[model samples]
Target: MPQLDDGSESVEMSVAMLRRMAEQGVGAVCATSHYYRQQNSIETFCARRADALDRLLVNLPEGLPRILPAAEVAFFSGISEKPDLGRLCIQGTRTLMLEMPFSDWTDLQVEEVSALVLDRGFSVVLVHPERFCSSKGNRQKLRQLEELPVSLQVNAGTLLHWMDRRVGLNLLREAPIPLLGSDCHNLTTRPPNLKEGRKIVIQKLGSAFLDKMDENAADLTRQTANATT
Candidate 1:
């Protein structure tokens, strides 16, 4: 899968980087967000975020990764709150790249978010679930999560950064074919590019798997774009 960070950088920065990477041959991107105002609720953030997206959409580069409105949305207080996720956004496709809290959560909390997504007629795509506080014990919980309508998104950084080889492999082994993403942001330490991440998948999972992942990503992104109307 093409590893890409959710575009949380400023619109100009993100656009420039995305345009540059596309010129360099980047395939797809999963624009994700992690920042949430501690003072303001999701409702407030949603309004501002949507306005920002609306402005950005008015002038995007002609050919960029099917920028999906995805999020590293955290499960706050066991509540998977839904902000104003517009249809054009990737997460608006009833596919939230849900992020669990940094600490462990009860199985009930996991179920709550998963069920909330499905109940809302949307799908949940768990994001880098291996990094959660319950990384060890959460396997069984995640296994149950798979039973629902959800997909797993593994962070390419996990492999590229060598933060946890076993976890990445174990997730690959256990979770359904995961969608790979870079989770990149900024031009410095986190320059936007999927080249290195794609290389790791080719080396570890074979080129065939890599191709299929790319195909799936393309298909989903197209579907996301079509949903914009």
Candidate 2:
């Protein structure tokens, strides 16, 4: 097993994932496992992630897409105060994939994220902001994030779900750095479907917009990879 986040549980799954992503014409991927601060310390989380990555890399099958290790760290009060918070950033870059709180965000919470970007030297990426859209205050806080350096990532399921599709498109329009995620959990029900979201993006935002999105994604990973390699 790869012991990776989402449903990438085994080498067989990796092979399956390669084919699945190929269908979407995706050439590279970020293995962003979840990091729950309540359950583990930074050292513990990194150790586990390293072990899983080692296991996966050792037995990796041929033709697998490039994998960049990262964590989707859940937000908590005073998280920016944690000295090791930078350890959670994506490998080779100071970009943190922040999973914003599901409940209404407070000024303190938003300020902490600001501190991360403005003070702590981190480029924060908010994962699946559409999930928090129902709360009016959350929506406003999302806007507040615009003042700071941040990226908004919408899930593929957002466009896949009819109820969320319109709201997701609107959210993308308001995003500072719009990114899309598959958020695939398993082989069935919830699965890799960035292709579906790409279709929606083209319909709503035009193919050129989606091309820029792809270029943005490529540029980010390529820059980081070049920096480290």
Candidate 3:
């Protein structure tokens, strides 16, 4: 339920957008704005995200899916060692949606994921492996990631051939990609069409795979609630 909003700039989120998302059967969405150290500090990004969430909530129509504040933190060196980085995890959950670098991952980068999982007890959900795992070597690296307690998330638009369809389909067929995100940005560009993605998923992997994905999402939501309480 993580929605990737335009982080570098101000974008309008309307009731129509939420209504469209609701129509797609989305119960809730995490407003995961991009967090890159080069662009802005964590504090500044968080403050902006909070402000945006407050503004959106004030004008939210009745019966629309709730929006939770979060950040899709950009992976960096020594991130696992940064103590305060946990504050950027999805609101109350231990889950962090990590947007991996476009280049091939280094050993230290891979080790950071392990540290985040085993030492810090965080659920590291890697976003859009299809983008990075374009080669056999990269796919092998993805398999290495699977060996850990990490989860993989694919964008719904990718499945619909909006992005690289071949890579997306390759990951869907081969990888244990459990989470399917709409990665919704705005109403015009990347609209929420999870229903379409779900149909594609069901068509390819069957209803059982969709059921398992739902269970995983529910478990993450439960974990978030428990952490808040």
Query: lDDT tens string, model 1, 47-102?
Result: 55566667667767787855555555666653444434433136435455567666
Instruction: Report lDDT (Cα) of residue 153, candidate 3.
Output: 80
Model 1 alpha-carbon drift over 4 Å, by segment: 1-9, 35-43, 54-61, 78-92, 133-135, 219-229
Per-residue accuracy of model 2 over 41-128 as CA lDDT, tens digit each: 9889889888987877787776667777788899988888887776777778778889988888999999999998888777788999
lDDT of 2: 0.80
Q: Model 2 Cα displacement at 140 (Å)? A: 1.1
List the candidate 2 regions with Cα displacement exceeding 4 Å. 4-6, 223-229
lDDT of 3 by residue, 81-174 (tens): 8756766777888888899888888777888888888987888888878888766666777788788867788888888884576566566555
Distance (Å) between predicted and true CA of 137, model 1? 2.1
Candidate with best TM-score: 2
> Which candidate gets the maximum lDDT versus the true structure?
2
RMSD of each: 4.7, 2.5, 3.1
All candidates: TM-score: 0.76, 0.91, 0.88
TM match of model 3 to true structure: 0.88
